[model samples]
Target: MAIIFEEKQNIFHLQANDTSYVMQIIRDGYLSHLYWGRKINQYNHSNKLQFVDRAFSGNPYPSIDRTFSLDTLPQEYPGYGNTDYRNPAYQLQLDNGTTVTDLRYKSHVIYKGKPALEGLPAVYAEDKNEAETLEITLEDQIADISVLLTYTVYEQRNVITRTAKIINTGSASVDLKRALSVNIDFRDADFDFLHLPGAWGRERHIERQPLRSGIQSVESRRGASSHQHNPFVALLRKGTNEDNGEVFGLNLVYSGNFLAQAEVDQFNNTRVSLGINPFDFNWKLNPGESFQCPEAVMVYSHEGLGGMSRTFHDLYRTRLCRGTFRDKERPILINNWEATYFDFNADKIEQIAKAGKELGIELFVLDDGWFGKRDDDTSSLGDWFVDKGKLPSGLEDLVNRVRNMDMEFGLWFEPEMISVNSDLYRKHPDWCLHVPNRTRSESRNQLVLDFSRKDVCDEMIKMVSDILASCPITYVKWDMNRHMTEIGSAILPPDQQRETAHRYMLGLYRVMDEITAAFPHVLFESCSGGGGRFDPGILYYMPQTWTSDNTDAISRLKIQYGTSLVYPISSMGSHVSDIPNHQVHRYTSLDIRGDAAMSGNLGYELDLSKLTEKEKEVVKKQVSTYKEIRKLIQFGDFYRLISPFENNEAAWAFINKDKDEAIVFYFRLLSEANSPFESFKVKGLDPLKSYKVENTNDIYGGDELEFVGLSVPTELNGDFQSHVWRLKALK
Candidate 1:
């Protein structure tokens, strides 16, 4: 069993693969966090957890002398307004307006299976033996609020998924102001904070800094898990690296506005919390009403950042993400966005598709501008029907033509957005999210649909569903171009205005659920102007995310690397686009772009028809090579050979599940005058076997290569140069 209860000590020992999390329900009815780290044979922290009265911090139970002071002790689920100053895990506002909750342990149940959140996306237990979940119910009688904290421990993944269910059990109503899904208090803050922060074009840049004494967090208030900040944060010991050291990581499985924070209190205790952002969020829970928070996946690694990352990769890749496309090999697709932008019509699209088909591309996707007089980003976002003017025969004919060319077809849609000049908007202007008197701020010449309203979401879902059902569309690239601005919903009352952002996300998720469920055979790829919505929440619906808007090989190194810190490479939608790169306008070798793109679900975003015979040959070779190694790149264990953050050249290795094959990609970003041939050791190799490099006749023992290292091509010397080395082992 993954979860074990020692009733005598009131300690619950939750084991997830190589890690163990211990917590205790104390004599005073407080559930205190005991320990979370590498597995131990037994837990003996109950005696050491005695709490004392602190000078400034107040206690929760004054009558229970010094058994445990909520102010000083670590907790499993710390509530707000009980005098504990650290950022709270849960908070409630009563009808009389007292925003206090004194929650105590009520009861708990341990089960073999994990329960699904009411209406949210979460990681599930694929098999009963894979994990066990424990539900700890805490309540405050006077406030009549009960918070159910659930912990699911994966036996082989070293991961713990946490969530909370807040219910108003009394006759009176209460407003939930800050109901974070997960929080864990560490005894000390002896770690560094690692986060991904960047702007629109450069999303998910790895940023690591020392944990200061105050609060350090990554959040998004733009009504999304914004491009500026991702919903992932990690704390590792000072010297932790990709391969070594203890690291604790948390990722919120939510796509909307969220907050992931770690606050080191004066006492040096660090409390890490994650969930829907409380900034512009509030939920009113009437009697018998409950609010289910999104799940927070927590992973603990004694083997360093890579271990932590792989744990997440394993769990999320198989359990968290659902759909027919989850583990299957994705199509080698060519999208027309970068190839033709918004100028493409049926003829232009067919030209590109024919070229891609000749080069063995499996799919051709008609990107933006195929619908509703959409020549540019300025108008016609919500109109899902094909533009008869562009495709004279309509979408069905184009889809059939692509299929006849032996290629699958995909289309893009920005269903969450509406143009001010669009027919949908002209008829129902108020349907767009806005305040009666506030200026309706527009982004990309479009307004965000008030998805928080069920009517609006239903319409969009119907439109999207109808379009997908109309044709044999194999994939969908669902894009949300803008973020919330007005912070108001036309159908929401004044007091419920704060609920707009999260409710909008909820509605958006509902639409996704409806569409994805209905189209079980279709593959969905979530995109928010590229990678803005690349989060676990969206990953639940769409297995892969467009890693970034910038497909430049040089820029993608950093973006994909940082994204890999939390997401598996398979989940990244990386493509080889034309040069000078679309976003950066920096010319890169076509082969180098292919090498970088091969690290993800490889595809192309260039005009294949424009390629010279030589360039076409190179792309053909790239596609064939990708097909040869796609299995290794997609499902194999990933190891970071070198970080782009600290080097002029980047390197990484992908080893197959059986350790029989390994592919190493080396990218040279700069030319150095006297730099010796780059040589580096590798990982995840069987020491006893002899492996042969495919390109060269060189053969070496696995240990010799993994320890002494594989050498780069010393003869190659140029900026933006790259080489792919695949090793086949002989038993």
Candidate 2:
């Protein structure tokens, strides 16, 4: 294992055998650096840094670019003036005795005991166990100025893990509020940035209906502040109080300007905040405290998300994958949420499994309503016992029956939730999260379990783990229905109410960590109402996430786009839902729906038994084609050729390594009648190479294909038309 570091540039590279990863302290770079363009040094300010130009300047441009100043100082506490008193001026101790002063503008500063290099530290150990831990420390001198940047490398599969810390070494206590933001740059031509209405609420955009524009920002003074401005951008704030304790929580701020009311006793002098956004998870750190976050692991590929997710899975394959599998390829698994709603049982599930097998499905997941007398949302949550009435014989028998049909079996469980009518809730009413004497709220007839309590977490863990131990279940769909409200914990005293959320999340992580450690072969999919808890933190434990409940292809175009900005497609749980849609009542072509869903894990949530013969044949061919190119699709380089948000038509492409092969899926969402040629030009290809075109109307060489981008036919003749083109470069 070799780790390379470039001290002058503050850049670090890690290489383990054949795999390589890069990390840079991007103090002055913008979020746009990830995709829009390359960075080029045009003017050299000093030997330490340079003024660079951004290659791409479309969407996601950085807010600012400035020189980074370096300084050396003697150890001191709150040195000098009032505001600048905390800023430390240190000597770099260069070989030459000439001391350099005021290297950069000093912002808020603190004392760092020793000097650490900016680049990756070389690892002398040959094994994972022997690998030395690398630490890089820098004091942020600029007060109130947040260091924001995006980290990416040319090659895919280059796992980049980064963690930041604000060490409070000053004598006078300082209040620190910070955020970590990640902007994903895989903008395909078909990407559409969706804008939602209502503050902390959900809304969709319609083409023909009234475009409800110009809505004022409304602030909700509920338990926490929430505002919903645009669908893509969401801000949630977690804060601390005066005495240095945890306050606020994972508050979902949609689009509001209201400040959170501070509870007098709830204030803490030292704390950290957890911010959950659509793109990245941000955290706030205080003095003497350290927050460890999951690193952003990247996998480079010539393939797409399907390929990338498989690559990610391969990282922990030893502990996850199991059973007699067909080929190393992932099974074309189909879930039943969008297919048959909450109306499924043992016989119904077996029928779906049989039909799925006919469609070449490798796994059959019986989602929801499988246990605890959970026929409806109104009853039996928190109760983990298998409902013998639902399964009849037992869960093991159902799993074995599914396995007997030459398919893997998976089940869904909401271990963190309990219904008021549930046996568990009836037995321990105090276990659910709620304020005494207050009306307990319910979403989907469920309330969150008080995982902050050790007993609650332990019992839930045992219930879930025991089931996995008793059955040969290959997959577990872990779902959390709603965000927390009425934030109170029975285990904590009044002063520790603010600690409830953090403790709850920590407890959840603990249980998951133990479960994964014990049943290393079982794959778990983390889902929160569908993409709410989708963050790198959760991804560290679960390989994939349920992308969203909105299965409408048009809606998914935006949801998946925003999601892909920070997360890889491999971790996205996309499925072919009903055409008329289950969540959002939007009608999308089945072919387009399948193509869009295939971009992710490539599964179906709709009932295969209900499909028409033609639809079934199309699905069969789709499954066949997916198997042939699934690797490329799953592990390829993702480029956002065109954003569906910007254009009426949606277009995106995936290119394999060597740039030898590529596939572009274009959708003419809303047709324009009497348009000239009804086609659009594509981008991001080698203009010099000649290429063969597959599955397209026009055959062109690489030169022509590069110079004269393919012409995708318009859907003016019909709604929801699509074009699938395969290109092979001739070197």
Clashes of 2: 69
Considering every candidate listed, which one attains the maximal TM-score? 1
lDDT of 2 by residue, 1-731 (tens): 23445557544454432244334445442111112111222212222323344232211223553221111111111112211212221111112322222112122221212121122111011233423234444343433222212222212232322233334333333332222212221211121112232311132221111112111122222221122222122111122111121111111211111221111111111111112121111223333444322122333322332333334343323222222221144456878766665677778888888888898878888887777887778888887878888788888888888899989988788888899988888899999888878988887788889887989989988999898999898888898876667878877766456556555666776787778668777767877667655554555567677777777787777666545544555667778877678676778778889888877778888888988989888888888888877766665655555557677777777777567788888777776667677454444456666667775445566556545667765443677767788888765
lDDT of 2 at 5: 50
Query: What tens-digit string does per-residue lDDT give for candidate 1 at 180-299?
Result: 988889988899999999988899998988888989988999998989999999999989998899999999999988899999999898998999888878898989999999999999
Alpha-carbon runs more than 4 Å astray in model 2: 1-329, 683-688, 695-699, 714-716
**lDDT over C-alpha atoms for residue 544 of model 2:** 74
Best model number under lDDT = 1
lDDT accuracy of residue 303 in candidate 2:
34
- How much RMSD separates candidate 1 from the native structure? 1.4
